[model samples]
Target: MGWVACWFIPAILQVVRKHLCLRHDLRGFDGGPSACSRKGCVSLSSCSEAVSMSKVLPAADTLPTVGKKLLKGRRYGLIAHGASITSRGKLILEFLEDAGIEPPQVIFTPEHGLFGEYAYMEPVPSDEKGWRGVPIISLYGSSFESLAPPQRTLSNLDCLVFDLQDIGARYYTYLATMAISMEACARAGVQFVVLDRPNPIGLSDIEGNIPKPYLRSFVSYLDVPNRHGLTAGEVARFFAYKRGLDLDLLVVECAGLVRPMQLPDTSLPFCPPSPNINDFECALLYPGLCLLEGTNLSEGRGTTTPFKVFGAPFIEDPFAFCARLNEFGLEGVAFKPLFFVPKYDKWAGKRCGGVQAVVLDRRKIKPLLVGLCIVWTAMHIYREGFQWRREPYEFEERWLACDLLFGDETIKTLIEMATSPFEVYEYMNAQSKSFVEESRDFFIYPDSV
Candidate 1:
């Protein structure tokens, strides 16, 4: 029966893929309404017209070209990371130089540092000799207070520009950095401009529940779902409106980037926004797999396949675990038995058994749900050994790390009661849908993209 179910599941998934007009490429999935070819797949280029119609222009691209006047004589402070580049493959700093605008007086970098080389939670130093010779500050410094720029820094600039690639997850930290900067700008009376980029996972894919107010931290600043689908610019707008901050907020929107198209579908180069998020697939799984950080398991941190595969030294039967996961019939993904040894993080230098989450169709995967199931399964199967990490997580010493990541204490309660993953997912879905409806007023891209 298990063998028959395995064969039937793939056949059904193949049909579902064809019906959804998904391409066979596992790198990323494009969901534009383009006609499929004879083999029931669409080439990435074939959806160019759809992407063009979306009119997705990153803020950096528009600033020098369409919005040149805005930068004239304005001593701007840019809050950017390595992914902040023009669509034409030029660094934003280089593009500013070509446009005759003075280089930024100060540059602020978020979590992964300016070059995107630092590992997770590593303190990024402020560069006195900044990128391209401007003074650079690290928003992701050691303390919570350091997450926001000082009033003196803000007073030095007329405008603050933010351009960071958000992976559409609330816990990603970039959004929180942007929110803190927005608040600081409000206090300092500086104009906050978000040079927008694609959400990578695209828009219209909202998931998870709003973080409980008490559980809020740097990782979960806003009360939005785990996968809030708005772009960074839109998030800026939302933050301004929700907080009712009396500040000038501008979102320089993206062009030719659409909600249906993931990064791999676009002509844009894939830059790892962080060390672990190396590709679109990693980003896709990140919304859920990141929850592993709160546990003792390795979320493939040291391996080449971070987030794609996860395991622990105590996991006794990888194949059995995979088989049980398959019974859930999770869409757009399949699990395979995996064994790996990591050189760093979690069970470093130790052999571990786990499962590799192979994405069969990006269009159908619910990453948040998949991640919840994996954690719940691990807890149930390895009853005695599976333990939640009690160490300080993201600076919170007392709270359960899982509570902060899940955004509510009820999730832990639900797991303890042995509730099914589907029930938890349904609860999250109900709340997330309402959030999407409520946040529609703040959406810059009100239409599909």
Candidate 2:
């Protein structure tokens, strides 16, 4: 009986691996029948070896050795953050200095400031005496005018280099900062370059709708999906091509990275891009969970676990709400009723009821769709208590918070009209498919190697 079990286990693993390889589009594995014998059968160790060969390293890891030549003899400005480091855990600035290149003349920081310790939307000041005495400028400020570097700032630079880690969600402001900086460089006749990084959410799973032109803000500057699954370099190229910016743009592409690979799949270290996005799970949930910002509900901002859990004081029956969510049979995630007291942000110091999203399988989770479903479910349960936040979000005061987050007014209208969440999901799925096809030309990495 024991021998039979051992023989069957290896055979089962071989079958499972074959199915997974086909589904994930992994190459080098031929899904053929394995030979097994009663005396000596294939062991689990060998099965593990079969699965390990598909991994790819991120671009940041290869940049120091392969991309350093691009920076030679150029006085450049860098738009980077704390997560802008090599896979070996060396800061990019230090790596440049070690390579005998002068550090950037001017450094620009995104939302969370240079060190990534500041709270979301916290204003960061330009520092002349910081970061090896290089002038540090904050791209994110209190107003739209502050988001872009002044023309004089870029006029003196030969190149503007952008190297921030993006989580692939639209609302994440780093991409917006890059676009704005690219445009500024174009106007100033400065060369623009991006040291590419992997899209933490992978490169194939684009989701949600593009923001309408009127609703466009810093968050929704590019007309891409809520989850644009391209790397930072690819996104820079797409933006430049779509907007017809007549600038010298160069992308130092990451070596060995391929499609359908998220951050965890790569061997690179995970540096939190912002205060709340602390892990790969948070990055996965961000596209959907971030939408909670435009609502009265707490998107778990003040809690240690932001975006992983969400609730509001109005949610009285969390168990029932979670159960209702489960009924939707959303793929790749499960919801659990939870009660939490936030120390800051919406409903601070108040106990709120909500659901904690547990990702069962990242490959199956459609974050944007799941987020819309959660919003729809909450609106249905809370009714009058549920409300879209009217406060200015991402420096856009005229547009409603939800509209700016979603990049479209129709999503809000659909939810308000009591439309089914499935209907909304179907609509978004179609939109996302079209977006993926349209944006294929800008892809630096192909879907298959």
User: What is the C-alpha lDDT profile of model 1 across 1-449, one tens digit per residue?
Assistant: 35764564344333321111111121223323321121212122233432453334465766554446777878888887778776666778788888777788999999889888788888889989987688889998888888999999899889998888889899999999999999999999998877778888877677788887888898889868888887787687777777899888776655555556677666677778899999999999999999999899899999999999999989878999889899989889999998999989999999999999999998789898889889889998898879998888877886888888888866665565444666566665665655766666554442332
Against the true structure, candidate 1 has what lDDT? Answer: 0.77
lDDT of 2 by residue, 208-267 (tens): 777778888987898788888888877887888789999888776654566777887777
Q: How many pairs collide in each candidate, listed in order?
A: 8, 1
Q: Root-mean-square deviation of each candidate, in angstroms?
A: 9.5, 13.0
TM-scores for all candidates: the values are 0.86, 0.86
